[model samples]
Target: MNDFTFLLPTKFVFGRGVTDRVGAELAAAGYRHALVIYGQGSVIRTGTLDRVLATLDAEGIEHTELGGVRPNPEVGLVREGVALARECGADLVLAVGGGSVIDTAKAVAVGVPYEGDVWDLFAKRAKIVAEGKLPVTCVLTIPAAGSESSASCVISNDELKLKRGLSSELHRPVVAFMDPELAFTLPAYQIAAGVTDMIAHIMERYFSSVGPVPVTDNIACGIIHALVEEAPRALADPRDYDAQANIMWASTLAHNDIAGVGRNAVAGGRAGGWECHGLEHELSAHHTGITHGAGLAVVFPAWMRYVWRSAPERFLSFGRSVFGIEPVDAEADGVDVTPEEAVADAVTATIDELQAFFVSMGMPRTLGELGVTADDIPALLETLEQNKGAVFGDLQPLTMDDARAIYESCL
Candidate 1:
């Protein structure tokens, strides 16, 4: 256990019909004008848009519509939303899709206050002012990426061909209304990608530290278990509300640090590296063919293989406790079998399983197969280096060489 402090001020209204509360909550929160951000018309087809707008109409909140936010959100779109907010006199920024929507709103919120280009935020040149970024909330349709309640947003630039994040306590949403029913409208590939991305959040946090936090470890393990179990169920029937609810809660809990709390927790402090995200971001930036989550499935386990030796015990714990993988490798190595081997094998198997899951759900499996090439790796590496530090949060303290090697290895 380590010294830690938890801060989650946003009200989470969960469950099937819980989103109906958003209209009254927005009024209570003093949001009069809103920028309703969403992707294409999927929300409209699902009737979610009508229900949400009706709620807002009842509450008398005026809003401007900003749609067409792409996956891996763009900085230009953020700017567009900022302009919309300014023009509409919108006090609230309402994100109505999945991770991309929420993240885009976050970028717009932060960018509105900064006089310079929003790219500065990605470059680590801007300090977030809590009051600066437009106040934002979400009607979450996807359970992946945990962006709804977090202060993290991944944004992209077309000229740079780069995707990076802007995070601050100031970026956290004021409230998040989750409706599992909306998720039913998502395609199978989208569902798979969301699940993979959500689990990566936990894996990154779980593998960072070398110390002990039994409770936190258990909670991380529990989230993984929930994901592994519910993923198949949800894919089989998108209408499985219980399965959807479990995964929805797991995704939120994983990133919110609700589980990883202890006196000596490794914390996302600076150790939890998002190498998987870097790889996936580059892939998504270059080719719209691969979803962020599928790329993560390929890259994350490879990362584990590269770095597992740093803290084998952590692997062992993850394997035995989380996935029930047996340590067969160490025994074959002429040493006493260890949980580390089991963990590593478990991760490899799970990543492969996830990739296969993607293929089954109509997604690409490999970098080369997706039309991503060795040529693209160089540009992707360039985009990844835009971070202030080598790695996203230092789980492995990525360097240019290390990042290059990871991309090359993924090939």
Candidate 2:
């Protein structure tokens, strides 16, 4: 266990019909005008946009709309949104779609009040102080990324082929409305991808290089188990409210820093390394069409295999606790094996099971499956090496050579 302070101020309005109260929630929060941001035609086609607009109209709240926030939301669109917010004199930024939409809204919220370009914030050239940012809120239509309740926003720049993330308490949503019913129409692929993203968030925290924090570990394992169990059910039957609700809430809890609290070093570093996410960011940044979750699926297991030897005990613990894989007894399989061999076997089985689960969910198991080739590896490694410097990960420091090995293994 470690010393920590936690604060989750996002007003989470969950359950059925909670989205209809978005207007009232904003009104009570003193936001009179909102710049509503959304993605392509789905919200409009489903009448979700109309419903939200009607609620705003009933509440006499004025608004402006910014549509067309794509999968890997671009910096140009975020700039346009900030301009629209300023033009409309919007007091709040409300996102009505998925993570991309919400992230765009958060960027706009910060950009609206800042004099400099918003890219500076993502580029780490400027700090996002709380004094100037507008409040952000969301009506989540997708359960991935957990951007609805998170303090982070990721934005991409197409010209540079870069995807960067910025984290600040100012980016956290003031309120989030989650209606699992809204997710019923998602395609099977998106559902699976979303669940994978949520699971990755927990795994990133679960594999931290910190002292034993039993409570946090238990919570992380429980969340992963819940998602692993419920995701397939939701995919098989999108209208399965129980499964949908469990996944939806788990997504929020995974990234809201709740599962990570008290597990980090007291000196302030994440227990688990985000090396996989750092690597996957390069993939998605170069190939904007690649799904974030799919890229993660391809990279995470490979990263695990490359690093597990450095922290075999941790992997053994994860295997036994999360996957229920019992360690092999010495000489149990008609072969004499040391205790170390037994632990390694359990860890290998757990990683295999994880990769199998990703495959079962229709995720790509290799970079080749994701359209990456031998030629692409160099550029990807360059991007990662530049951004991450010489090494990545805390559980086991991964230098450029280690990263190259991981990418090669993924291929």
Candidate lDDT (C-alpha), each: 0.75, 0.87
- Residue-wise lDDT of candidate 1 within 1-411, one digit each (tens)? 666666787778888796788889899878898889998778878878778888899999987889998777888888888777777777888999888899988888877878887778887887776665688899999888898887578887877777777657777798999878777767877888788877788777677654767877888888877787898888999999988888887878877766555522344342255667766777787676566887887777667767766776677667777657545666576766476555666666644554565466555555676677778777776766764355454445667677677667767
Deviation from truth (RMSD, Å), model 1: 3.2
Candidate 2 on 140-230: residue-level lDDT in tens?
A: 9999999998877999898877788887767789899999999999998898888889888888887878866788888888998888899
* Total backbone clashes of candidate 2, pairs 3 or more residues apart or in separate chains: 3
**Candidate 1: deviation at residue 388, Å?**
5.6
Query: In TM-score terms, which candidate is top?
Result: 2
True-vs-predicted CA distance for residue 108, candidate 2, Å: 1.0
